[model samples]
Structures are given as C-alpha cells and as structure tokens.
Target chain A: MEQSGDRVTLGLDEVFAIAKSVLVAAGLPERQAEPVARVITEGQRDECHSHGLFRLPGCVQTINHPRFNRAAVPVVENTTPAVTKVDAGFGYSLPALEAAMPLFVEKARTVGISVLAINNCFHFSALWPEIEMLTAKGLVAIAMTPSHSWVAPAGGSRGALGTNPIAFGWPRAGQDPYVFDFATSAIARGDISLHKMAGKPLQPGWAIDADGNPTTDAAAALDGAMLTFGGHKGSALSTMIELLAGPLIADMTSLESMDFDDGVKAAPAHGEILIAFDPAILGGGVRDNQASSERLFSAIVDQGARLPSVRRYEARARSLAHGVQIPRHLYDQVMSLPRAG
Target chain B: MEQSGDRVTLGLDEVFAIAKSVLVAAGLPERQAEPVARVITEGQRDECHSHGLFRLPGCVQTINHPRFNRAAVPVVENTTPAVTKVDAGFGYSLPALEAAMPLFVEKARTVGISVLAINNCFHFSALWPEIEMLTAKGLVAIAMTPSHSWVAPAGGSRGALGTNPIAFGWPRAGQDPYVFDFATSAIARGDISLHKMAGKPLQPGWAIDADGNPTTDAAAALDGAMLTFGGHKGSALSTMIELLAGPLIADMTSLESMDFDDGVKAAPAHGEILIAFDPAILGGGVRDNQASSERLFSAIVDQGARLPSVRRYEARARSLAHGVQIPRHLYDQVMSLPRAG
Candidate 1:
C-alpha cells in the first residue's frame, strides 16, 4: 500500500486481504466473510466509491449487532421447479446468494426461467456483482432488494419506502456484460452521506424536508425523505420490489426491517429476489440473441450515448492496471476495526 | 346511447360492440376481434382514454395493412417447463395472449413462476388489461413490449429506442388489483399525438427536436425523438424491453419494427413478454401475501399518496354506474367504418 497526501493506493490483493481480515476480525466466519469481502473489493476495483471501502464500517457495525449471527450457514430450499429459496439465517446476504447461485443457474437452464429468493439477510452491497455472475454463465439476470425505510413514495409526505434498487444483466459474447444497477430513489443514501460529509447541499428535487416540502439541505433530506427517481413510475417499481422481495417471499418489508433495527440503523436485514433467464430456451439462439443486442449497442454508441456500465468498465481496466485509490480517511476508518482471535 | 353537447354516452356493451364492429369491418376475424375489442372497451371503462376509443382508428389501420393476416390462428408451444411461446401468425397480440393465458396460469402455479412470449403480433393497446387478467387469477404479473423507434436513448442524439412500456399487477382480495402500466419514454406517443392535435406544446423534458436539442413543440418532437422518463434509468429499462421482448423471443427490436413499417408507421409489429408468479408456490399463502400487501397499500394511503390504479378504479366505478362518454368526433369516426359482410 502507498499513501499520498490525502489518498492511499493499494493492490487488489491487499484490498481483498484487508477487507477479509476486517470482516473475520469482526467475527464473520470465513464462509460469510469471503463473499462480502470480494464484493466490496470489486466495488472498489470498479470505482463505485459508494459501495467500496466506505461501506466497511457499516459492515462491521452490522456484524457486531446483537441480532447478527457470526457463524451463519445459509440453508437452500428447492421449493419448486422454478424457485430456489435460501434462508440466510440472519447472516450477510452475499454468502446466501453465493450458496444458491449454482441452483439458480441450473434451474434457469432446465426450466428456462427461475427465481432465487434470499430471506433473513443483511444487505449492504451493490447488486451488479451478483447480476454479472449469472451473465458470466451465459444467462440474463435481474435482482432487487429492499433496504431500510428512508425514501418516500412519489406523492407521500413521510418515509415509507426503501431506497430499493433493481439490477439487470445481459451476456455479451467476448465482451463485458451489459449490466445496470440503480436505486429507485432519487438519490442513493450513501451519496447523501457523502454530501453531508462535504457540507454540500443536494440538488433540487432530490428530496423533501420532514414536512414534505422540497429541500436541498443534505442533513434535512436525510432526516426527512428522499424522493423516487421518475416520480410515480419509480415509486411503482419500488412498491413492486417491496411486495416481490418482501411479502411474496415471506420476508420483512422496509418498514418492518427498519423497526427491527430498533434505532441502531445497522445495515438493513431483509430479503432479495433474483431471476435468471436462459435465452436458448426462449426460442432464440443464445449467440444470436447476443449478436442482435450488439446492433442495439452499436446504435446507442454511434449516437454518442454511452452504456450504463461503460465508466465502471473503464475504471476496472485502470484498477487492474494500477491498483485502486481510496480516500485516506476511509482507509483509516476501515483499518480501525479490531482484530479477531 | 345518449348524446349531450359534443359527447355521446354509451353502455359498456355498446362500447364493445362498436369497437368489435369496426375491427370486424376492417377485416379482423371474430376470434381476433373479440379480445381486441374487449381490451379497448376495458380501457374506456376505466377511463384510460389514450388506450380507449382513441386507439380504434389505429387498430383499424393496422388490421387493414397488407401484411396483416385476416384469418390468422395463434399457435401455442410449450417450449420449456416454465416458458410458453405463442406465435400470433402476424395477427393481433390480444388473441395470441388469450390463447396462451391458460398455460401461463397453469405453469406459473406449478413452477412458482413462468414466462409467456407472444411473437409476430401487432400490439396497439395498454398492457394493464393483460396484467389485470393474471392478477384476477391470483397471480402477480409483469409485461413489456417494444414499439416503433420514436425515442432516443440517454445521451443519444437520434431516434434509437421505442416508447417501450412496462406493466405490473398484484392481486388484492375483494378490491381492485394493484396495477400500473407506464411507458419508459417521458410521455406516451399517444399523448404526444394528442398534444399535437390539440395544438399544445409539451413539457420541456418530454422530447428533443431533430437537431438533438430539447424542444416543447409537439410537432417537432413527433418528427424527432422523445426522451425517456427518468433519464438514464428509464433508458436502461427501455433497452431491457427491447432485448427481452425483442431478440430474446426472436422478434423485432423497435428499430427493426420501424424498418418493417417502411414509413407507413402503423401500430408496431413486434413481440410481448409476460411473466407470472404464484405466491402460494413460493411458501406464502395466497391470502397471506395479499393481506401483507394491504399494509403497504395502507401505508401509502395513510400518508396522502395514492396508489397507481386508484384513479382508474374510480373512473371505472363511475363508468359502470353511468355509461362511458366519448367525444362526438371520435364516435363519428367509428361509425364511418364499413361493416363486414
């Protein structure tokens, strides 16, 4: 690792090692700690700073919570021909999703489409990693999860919705997968926190004060409610996520998840819903479908429109070539975690 | 029927009859005309004017197209355990979806989730009707379709995407189903046309002129490109629809669909993809999930936020109590069509 004026640069190996050590030291068993560490490292490698080392303190806080299970073993259930359910036993969502991925891929190929439901887990990472995993296996993937209640419905005055995110991935032949993961909320909570840290106000329309009036103050918006991305359309998507990833899977809603925090607000414990589709089984040759998509991609590029993951991929190339750079303060905070026995 | 001022009020039966007569008169067979008419009537009954009687002229135009098959028969194929494909034989999508409905419900109930693909069909109505059909059968439904390439992708300067719409439905016991169908574009094409017809300008963010600059003139936007609803997020969704409903089903993307039009620009001929989910098979009782969703509905309502379908339901109740009202010009247009022998 090398330290500069205000940032530290570390090789990918050192990044993963430090994350894993911190997780393990905080009492997460190896099975659960590894996937979480890998996901965080990938975020850093891709320069998605919000989901990178900045998330370390929250992961440690959640791991140290009384309700968290240190040695959780995710149990997978084959509930139906097209559904695979994983009960994470109150552990991290990453390991549970990792445990059920093979089943997801198998069922998708056999049934043409399948659902993988993960319940009773704490989620604090971006969904692109999991989406890319399925795309890597030559399948299309979609994933969604509800977080703590911090956003308001489109026309609502108070916080009653999570900053729910939806992610999608499509396989590309000999190229990076077409992937996008986004919060239905107008702004991600991490960005808000970053703004608050920098003493900056938010852009207009991003949020409302506690009284439901529009406000640009980051602190006020955090204490109040964040708006959805596309007004009612985004709200509808968020509500759908709450229903599909929540009640349909027999798990906690955002409100219920928030209540479970009992004010501590450690990473929200909830559920996730992931779906996989095998292009070949849908009557199209997988390679042909990929080829067809290339045309659409070309059209977008020809018009000077960049794909959603383009920047991330560019950052990934840089990180692979010259390691990752992180703010010094964030590195110090992560390094402050106490070591385990 | 009763006439007052510039409007005419007709019972639901009359509404269906008029729509069916016009379709049949334009050469659609009874089997195809029935479902199409039913969907249009439902749109009127629910006061979704864009998809109601306003769509009749376009439907007739498409039905009379040279490529349309007047005696088309939809064929359903059980492609996979959880995937059902219906080839509409270049007919209307309604009948194709109708032919596959039973299989969709059965497979979803058995497999916990399923996909229904309708290909080689012309789609010209709202997807809410189909979503509501699945919701009525106690299933959660999501549907999407690509249209003519009249919208541009985010950061793109030309027309490369469709006003792709996505719809979702969730069942609610003894009440109207929770449903929403929205175009990924900033505005629906029909609405833009309506604005043009009314000699009104569009909202600032709704579209761009031919030169790739934002414009409020409805005519310029119609001749140029429409913007997506939520900028990049909505653009991603529109692209997803293009792939999922298009190449994934061996059907046409929006641009290809437009090419097939050859400048005539009739209703889009493409494919639709619908996915169904059964809560009971996913370890939650059907009623339990419905009851759980009720709380979310209540939360939104308690805070002055209205559910997406509330206004439609209200209009439906009023229409049922006192027949639908239509503008005189629209009624005259329908009345002018020649009757089939």
Candidate 2:
C-alpha cells in the first residue's frame, strides 16, 4: 500500500490479503474468513467503500463478541424439492451462502425455481454479491435481508423497520450481469452517520425527529428514525422482507434482531431469503430471451438512461488494471484492529 | 339499482350479474365471463373503481377488436416441477389465471415454491384479485405484469416502460390476507386521466412533458411520460417486471404490447407472472410464522402506522352487506353499450 496525502492505493491482491488477515486475526477460522474476505475485496474493487475494508473493524468486533461464533460451520439441508435451508450457526452470512449455493443452483435447475433460506446469520454486506453468483450461473436471482431496526414505517413515528435491501441479477449473454441492490430506506444509515459527522443537514423526507416530525437535522434523524423511500411502497417492501427473510425462515425480525443487540450494536443477526429461477426452464431459453432483454436495455440507454451497476462495472474494470484507492485513515484502522491470539 | 342524484347503488349480486351480462352480450362465452365478472365485482366491492365496472366497456371493446379472440380457451401445461404455464390464446388474463391457479397452488404445496406463467393475454384489471386467490388458498403470492408503455425510465425522456404493477399477498390465520398491489409508476395512468378530466394539476414528481421537462399539466404528461415511484429503485423493479413477465414468459414487452395496439388504445396485450409459496413447507408452518408476523403488524399499528389494504378490507365488509355505489353515468354507459347478436 502507498500512502499519498490522506489516501492509500492498494492492488486487489493486497486488499484480499489485508481483509483475510484482519478477519483471521480477529477470530474467524480460515474456512469462514475466506469468502467473507473475498466479498470485502470485491466491494473495494467495485468502489463500494461502505462495504469494503471500511467494514473490517465492525466485522472483527462482531466476530470477537461472545454471541458470534467465529468457528461456526454452516449446515445445508434440502428441506423440500424447491427449498434449500442453511443453518448458519450464528456465523457470518457469506460463508453460509457459499456453502449452500452449489446445491441451491442444482435445485433451481432441477425444479425451474427454488428458494434458499439462510437462518441465524449475521449479515453486514451488500446483497449484490449473492445475486451475482446466481446470475453467473445463468440464473435469475432475487435476494433480500433485514437489518437492525433504524427505519420507521411510513406514517409511523418510531423505528420499527430495518433498512432492508432487495437485490436482483439478470445474466447477459457475454457481458456483466444486469444487477441492482438498494436499501428500502430513503438513504442508507451509514450515509446519515456520515452527514452527522460532517455536520451536514439531511434531506427533508429522509428522516423524522424523535417525536415523529420530519426533520433535516442529521443527528436528530439518526437519533429518531429514518423514513422509507417512496413512502408506503417502500415501507411495504421492507415489511415484506421482514416477513419473508425473518419469520418465514424461522429467524429474527428487525425488532427481534435489535433486541438481540442489547446495546452491543454488532451486525444484525437474522436470516435471508433468496430465490433463483432457471431461465432455460422458465423462459424456455436464455438465448431467445437475450434479444428481448437487450432491446429493453437499448431502449433505456438510447434515451440516456443508465442501467443500474454500470458504475460498479466501470470501477471494476479500472480497479482490475490500476488497483483501488482507500482513505488512509480507514486503512490504518483495519491494520490496527486488535488480534485475538 | 337506485339512482340518487348522480350516483347509483347496486347490490353485489347485481354487480356480478351486470358484469357477466355485459361480457356475454359483447360475445365472451359464459365460461370466460364468469371469472371476469367475479373479479370486476370484487373490484367494486373493494372500491377500486378503476378496475371495477368502469372497465367493463374496455373489456367489451377489446373483445370486439379484430385482434382479440373472445372464445379463446386457455391451456394449462405443467412445464416443470416448479412452473405451471398457461397459454391464454389471445384471451383475457383472468380466465387463464383462474385455470392455472389450482395447479400452481398444488405445485407450491408439493414442492415449496412455484411460478405460474400466463402468456398471450390481454391484461387490464388490477392484480390484487389474483393475489388474493392464492392467499385464500393459504399460500404466499407475488404477481406482476407489464402494461402499455406510458412510464419512462428514471433518467430517460420518452416512454420506455409501463405502469407495471406488482402485487404481494400473505395468508394470515383467520383474518383477511395481508395484500398490497401497486404500480411501479409514481401514479396510475387512470389517475392522471381523471386529473385531466377534472382539470386538476398533477403533483410535481408524477410526470414529465413531451420535451422531457418536469410538468404538472395532466394532458402534457399523458402525451409525454409518467415517472416511476421512488426514482431509480422503482425503475429497476419495473424493468425486472418487464423481463420476468414479458420475455421470460414468451409474451410482449410494454412497448411491443403498445405496438400491437397500433393506436387502437385497447388494454395491453401481455403476459403475467405469479409465484406462490406454501408457508407450511417453506416456513415449517404458517401457524408459527403467524405469531412473528402478528408482532410485526402490531409494531406497525402500535406506532400509528396503518397496515396496507386495511381500507380495502373495511370497504369489502361494507360492500358485502350494503353493496357498492357507482356514478350514474358510468352505470348508464355500461347498460347502453352496443351488444352483439
């Protein structure tokens, strides 16, 4: 890593090494640490700083916590013809997903559609990585997970929902998969924290004050509740995630996850739901559907509209050749994380 | 029916009878008219006037169109273990949905999840009735369909997408199923028409002018493009629907559906995708998830946030007892429609 001014540039290999080392030193076994590190590295490569090495300290803290099982082994079960369940054993979600994904893909191909339920996992990453995995295998994928309760339901005052995210991925014939992952919250909780740290005001509809009044004060909004995007529509999607990824998987809801935090405030421990569809079976053939899908894409871009993830793919290309730049302070923090043994 | 001032009130029975009579008179066979009439009656019962008897004339027009096949019979095929395919044979979507739903539900129970694809259909009504059907069968349901291209992608100028409604339904224990059906567009096209008719200016974010500039003029927005709800997130969802329900099912995209209209402006001819999940299989038992789900509901309601579809359910109860009221002019329009021999 080369430090210049307040930033450092590191090659992708270095990023992976640093992430894996930090996770291993923190307490996660090599088996569980590898996939998590790869996901982190990919985040940096794609310029998603929020989920990159910046999150290593938080991951370490969660791993070192008493409730988190750093050495946990995920068990995958074929519960039904169209359902695959993974008991994550209180471990990080990435490794559990890695464990189940192969079988999940098989089931989807066998049945035309399938659901993957990952229970009792601590999740602190973007859902796009998981979605991309399925798309890479020529499948259509939708994934969602609930976070801690920090968002308010539309028309409600207090926080009762998470910044639940929904991600989708569609495979292309010979290009990067079409993908999008977004929080149901008006804005990410981390963005609000950044605004608070910078002493900046938030947008009007982004949040409400403690007493349920709309507020632009970042600190007040953080202390109060964030609003869902598009009002009730976003709220409904968030609630759906809470139900499908939560109790539908026999895991915790956002409220239950918050209660489980008990002031420790580690990454939210819950479950995730993902569905994959085999295009060959559902759409008859991916090659045939490709033409129709491309038309839609051209229609969007021809009118100067950008498809989602174009920026990420562009960054990925640049990073593959020239590495990624990270803030010096964030790099220093990752290096200074306390080792367990 | 009793006319009071400009409005007329009719019992639910009368609503169904009128709907069925209008369809049969327009040359739709009795078997096809029955399910379509029941759906229209339900729409009026729930006070969704846009899809109620007001739509009867559109159905008649579509049925009478040279391209439409009023007597087309839907054929259901169990394409895969997890997919049920229905060829609507250029007929209305409701009958195709009705024909396939039983097999779809059985597949969901036999496996854990199932997808129903209804193709080559003219879809004009709201999707809630179909979602409610699966919910009534004790399955969690999601349905989506592309309509006429009238909405624009988030950053684009011209119309490249449809209102593209998505609906979700979750079965509850002994209560009405939790259901929500909403268009991905900022507002429904019919609402814009209503606003234009009433000489009311639209809300700012609802639409853009023909030149792609933001506009509050209802007529200009209608001639131009409507915006998606929540900006890019909704746009992504709308795009997903286009891919899933359109090409994925070997049916028409919104633009193609509009092209088939060729300025005739009948209801969009497209395909629909519906997925059903058996809670008993996926979540172990719906009874267990019911408790967790109830708590989430309580949290939302306890915080003064209204649950989605509460108003619809309330109206449904009232309509069951006292029936529904319609504008007298609309009633007369339906009654005086030109009928075939």
> In candidate 1, what are the lDDT values of residues A175-294, reduced to their tens digit?
999999999998888888889999998998789989998999999998899999999999998999998888888888888899898888799998899999998888553236666678
lDDT tens digits by residue: candidate 2, A202-236: 98899999999999999999889999999899899
Q: How many backbone clashes does candidate 2 have?
A: 0
User: Model 1 misses residue B144 by how many Å?
Assistant: 0.3
Task: Evaluate model 2: give its TM-score.
Answer: 0.98
Clashes of each: 0, 0
- Candidate 2 local accuracy as lDDT? 0.89
- The C-alpha lDDT values of all candidates are 0.89, 0.89
- Per-residue lDDT tens digits of candidate 1, residues B103-184? 9889999989999999899889799999999999989999999998899999988889998999999888899999999989
